[model samples]
Target: MRASVSTGQDLGMPAIYLHLLAELLNTIGVDEQDLLLRVGLDPARLQSTNLRVSQPQASEFVTRAIIESGEPGLGILLARELKLPLHGALGTAVMSSRTLGDAMELVTRYLTLRVPHLKVSKRENGSLAWYLVSCGIDLGPLQGFIMDAMLFGCVSMGAQLTGSVVDGLRILRRGPEPAYFQRFRARIPVPVEFGATENALVIPLARLSLPVRFTDDQLAASSRAQCEEALQQLTEDAGFACRVRRVIETSYPFPPKLARVAGTLFVSDRTLKRRLHEEDASFQQLVDRVRLERAADLLRNTAMNLSQIADALGYADAANFTRAFKRWTGTSPSQYRNTWKAAGVGKKTAERVPVAG
Candidate 1:
């Protein structure tokens, strides 16, 4: 099977993430050298946080690590190890913010430095605050692992910032409830709602102003300066393909409209078009890429059939999904699955109706 949707371009993720995964493996008494190699990453090189690897490399690494370690809740475990200073200057800035609200503002502003492939923002209504998140690329089967880690990381980082649980916080996760969701709840005592409209952390508005225990105006100012510069550099370094891909990834009900995606990104449709042009990409290209990758992942990872897979991928019908799949891979969906099954590898997919979340 293809390792990931990405073409092994883009500095995919900071080396720290892969390294942390390695540590997670170590803790579980599993050897990680082969897992890293499966994705063209060297175990030794991951020791330096400055190194970069392609998005596919990181995604494949995570998938393989999860399979090998038999830990579906790897994301939650990884989040626990990401304490302060682990996020670099972004952590410094977050640590010194005046209050939980301020820290969150800084986090939404600078989180890209830690994980550029995602966009998370904070929105407030009358009595609730939402830490809304959207992916910048298709995560395929790894979506659960990635989203779990990110939401759980937010909880962990929140506690570090405020020196408290930052009470009255709950998680709103997209997709069905995986059995592993409880791993996150175990680490951070918070309510989690699955099959939600979006991926977010819902908080009581009252908790937003809780004081950050170690706020320092001077440190925050300096760290913010560094974070701003780093954000600019990383923005260009990471490229916009993943950013656009993320829009496709998080759009619920399969594909989202281009104008809607632009609006979500806080840009005019025309501007969104122009920016994608500069990246030598387009909305349709990203949509197809995400859809195709997700289709393959579903076939390989889930027991969903062609029709069910088609529905999940936003196809109007199985025939349409079959045509698209053949065009994308040179073979039909059944052909692809049969070929893999014949090879005696991949997920042990069986016929079963998916349970309602």
Candidate 2:
């Protein structure tokens, strides 16, 4: 977990997801009050429109659900409730977009307002589009399950937006297909590939550009404004650390300087320093955090070398990058890359470690 902050405060993933979990458990005969208590969540705090829970708390909540309900596929099962309408203004913004492409673009832009820990990156090349999904931190036992729900939910929304099964849509998973595939078999229109190099949603570009039947400019604008307002409120609600992270994450040249980051947030350097101090975070800490995330992505996803990565991240040279990488993960860049490269071998061994009794 690179996702877990050094800060002691448990500000982690968004809790809007709890709404769906609560709903799903209620339908399956789980007591809502008991569920809340078991997960160490306060019913009152969960009611806030802008509440966030720690990553450990969320993992425990889902783990408890799976154990109590006897549904290991709980994450995928959550797709039934992930409809756009069930979401708030953010959903409305997506629904009102002019086309599926526009809708996805909005999602990429605004999703952090609801779930800060999930990051969606999108790329387009003529008729092919790649939407890659990743978590800010390792999500523990629920990692695969939660990813399933997210990818499947995206496809489900595509159908709702287009009024038909999306054409030429395939999901790429980083690991083997789970045994519970049949639970949502009919829902996916195209073949899903396991052991994929990347976890992505592949769609024919034309399908995304197709006009949405219910596209309304006025509604789109109004809903988008609400989304903006809500996002601003969320930034305010979450506190200075998140705001600081947002600034660093968006800045180019990888790790931005403290003065530049403070400038973007429209606060004086001293004020920014004071605010972060209040939140128990430092500018240098956030720089390392953002740099670590980018470095990890580059190391895992790109063929960039030490010099290339160092230059891209504004480091002086390969030696500087090596030192930073060591500080971040306790390993040099090449070693970390090798570890990820050989991870698949361990995955297979771990999968078959226990023979069925």
Candidate 3:
């Protein structure tokens, strides 16, 4: 199936990842379907490998999974189950790659297609090479789970590609070791060191030339071509408006100015405006949309007062926020929050409620 990326409102984590997670939860005795239902995700939608779950819903589901299962080591466990073929084109490219180095390069470049929030970069010293892993956004409590899945998944993938662990490979993590590590340590193929400078997979430079077990030059070339096309399509489909919305969504000092947002996106102010205009979007409109979404979430879930919510959304004051909010929703902030509460909607139930435009 062909995959298409979307704007910030529709960008999501791959549903397959969540599908695998739910399976793992079920194996561990958690009622996976109920959890998915509570998060407003249909269980059957995950069957399609190309489908994606919206970021908010995915986050909520994952958070609840960890809490319900009480398995902080879920990521590590999930890594073991991620066979090469499950990774789609990137996996095919890696499997057909001529050398270990070639496969690593494909992964570093195309990982965002699978895990949008994580980035991988390669660094080489005199004798040792490191694939440094980092996240694009603040994942908060999910940071460890993501890091574990990524770093450990790399270790598992290496063994799968080469049919054995690469010589002198190890894992380096930034924080102190978690208590759950001892249970899974035997399952990991390589030594793992905690309290390191960064999260990375370390390997000897010479091993980079090791041949992949199933290397096929023609297939590798074709698969690499597919990876290139997929990457291009994903970026193009995001569109200029989507790109601008992404910057606005993640911007610090919430509600950044036009020039700042443009600079962050590596475009001049005029170019940014023209491109967004071509996409039929305005900067202030996009900012207001994001603010309104956040405002709704705060109103529905948090006990924060209007002043606090306004300040969090970068409004000048509560009065200004109330005026803009009324313009957007036809009700004052207090009224909105009160009405939401009066409906007896909690976090889990609120996910199923359709938002009125």
Best by TM-score: 3
TM per candidate comes to 0.63, 0.61, 0.65
What is the clash tally of candidate 2?
0
Instruction: Report RMSD (Å) for each prediction in the order shown.
Output: 18.2, 21.8, 14.1
Worst 10 residues of 1 by lDDT: 348-357
Clash totals in order: 5, 0, 0
lDDT of 1 by residue, 1-357 (tens): 332344322435667777888988988987887666555455655665554555555666788888888888888888888887877788888888888888888878777677745688788888999989987656676667777778888888778877777788898988888876665565567788889988998889888888888889999999999989977876675556665565456444458788766654456889888988998998898898778767876777768988898998888899999998888777888987787778776855433322212
Candidate 3 TM-score, C-alpha based: 0.65
In the range 1-357, model 2's lDDT, one tens digit per residue, is 364332323335556677678778899898866876655565544544444665555666788888888888777778767878667777888888899999988888887765555678898878889998877765667676678778878878888888976889998988777777767667667678888978899999888887776788998999999888877876575677776775455444356668866654556899989999999999888887767776876777679999999998889999999998887677788987787778854233222111112
Q: Cα deviation of 283 in candidate 1 (Å)?
A: 30
**Alpha-carbon shift of residue 133 in model 1 (angstroms):** 0.8
Compared to the true structure, candidate 2 yields what TM-score?
0.61
State the C-alpha lDDT per candidate: 0.74, 0.73, 0.79
**Per-residue lDDT of model 3, residues 1-357, tens digit only:** 222222232345677888899999999999998887666565755755655555555666778998999988998999988888888888899999989999999989999887776789999999999999887666555567778887888888888888888879999999899998999998787999999988898989999999899898998889888889977877675677766765565444577789876764556999988988998889998998878887887889889999999998898899999998888888888888888878777555444323347
Off by over 4 Å in 3: 1-11, 239-357
Off by over 4 Å in 2: 5-16, 43-50, 236-357
